[model samples]
Target: MALPEPGADRRTLDADRATAVPTMRSAAPLLKTSTAGALLAIAVMVAATVGAAIWLSIIDQRRQAQEQLTRQAHAAALQIRARLIETEQLLLLEGSGYAASADRFRRDMEELLDANPALLRVELRGRDGQSLVGVDAAAPRPTVAAATRTALSPEAAAAFDSAARMNRLTYSRPYYVTFGATGFDLMELVVPTGAVDGPMIVAVYAPQRILDHFLPSDQ
Candidate 1:
């Protein structure tokens, strides 16, 4: 009838068993849940890192492509400039010899126009801004964008004005100009033609059709 002592083997065994069973049961679920959470977190981190890397790579590629395009444009401009310089040299060599005759200058300019038909027209503008003669004699002057209409848009006019004031070679943006004799878009190019030692201006016009060679396909 008296209670067993606290330290008795029978009571101690019962308490130990009760504590162990519940502890084991609770610990099993906690351990499993912790492992599963850790795995999910690792997977998410890996995916985010990979996505960021791919995005950065794409942006870098785009930048490189744009740089390449810029280089190509610069190269094209340089090539055109070199050809113009060569033509100027030829003109100077022949201009004085042909001063007594019109045939010689006409022949030289005609040859240049024939060699580069892509050029819509080439005009030798005197210091007084008078067009001496046009390379394409057949190309009719356009009434819409007449010779007086140097600037197709306001921006183009402003650029031309700046270049003209500086007495430097000036070029206009891509524009459509109806031929005086025919309706066709002419992409214009103007260069300064004169003595390297003195002020001079030369104007050249190229047809828009020629731009097809320089411009890339939309696709």
Candidate 2:
């Protein structure tokens, strides 16, 4: 009466195990689906973060490139202006010498041409368009009429005419020229001698010289 049946206890334990196994098996698929969903969400977040970083990097690079180009342009402009000022000063000194003596003016022109090879030619013109003193006579001469009509823009020509009438130093726009074996863009400057009806100085300069002086060789 007091002893339980061994087979009966074994059967009851086997039933309990069978019921627990199915319950565990039923919950496993739901757990697996939740884990997969979590993994997919993490992957999407990582990809979105990487894409945003790449786009921002491209924008930053473009901005830096634009800034560098702007700096180079500004530096080039300043160098050109400085060279023009230097040419103006030289022309003023020569104009004074021209007024004093014809021989002295010729000597000064020769020296200028020797000192600065960038200066291709120099011409002094009297009130009646007569050539007073000239250097590099073999080189093609620059004419104001041609400059105003074709070589220079209308705005530049107008500016040149106004500056000439007021007896002021003025430079023309860049024009192409070939002297002997060398060819380059040339700029002309007309410097007044303070006498409206007196002789004026015309000086031709190469802009490549200014660039060679200021810019890097690789550029």
Instruction: Choose the strongest candidate by lDDT.
Output: 2
Off by over 4 Å in 2: 1-20, 99-120, 136-164, 173-187, 205-219
- Which residue pairs clash in candidate 2? none
Clashing pairs in 1: 140-180, 140-181, 141-180, 193-201, 193-202
Worst 10 residues of 2 by lDDT: 141-150
TM-scores for the candidates: 0.57, 0.60
lDDT of 1 by residue, 1-219 (tens): 998776798888999999999999999999999999999999999999999999999999888888787787777667666665665566555444433345655676667766554554555444444455554534433233335443234444543454546645565665554445665554444344334323233334554544444544433
lDDT of 2 by residue, 1-219 (tens): 688876999999999999999999999999999999999999999999999999999999888887886787678678767766766787786676686677877787777766654576677766544566666523332222223222334434544565568778877788765545655677767787666577777776666766665654332
User: Looking at model 1, how many pairs of residues clash?
Assistant: 5
What's the CA error at residue 179 for candidate 1, in Å?
4.2
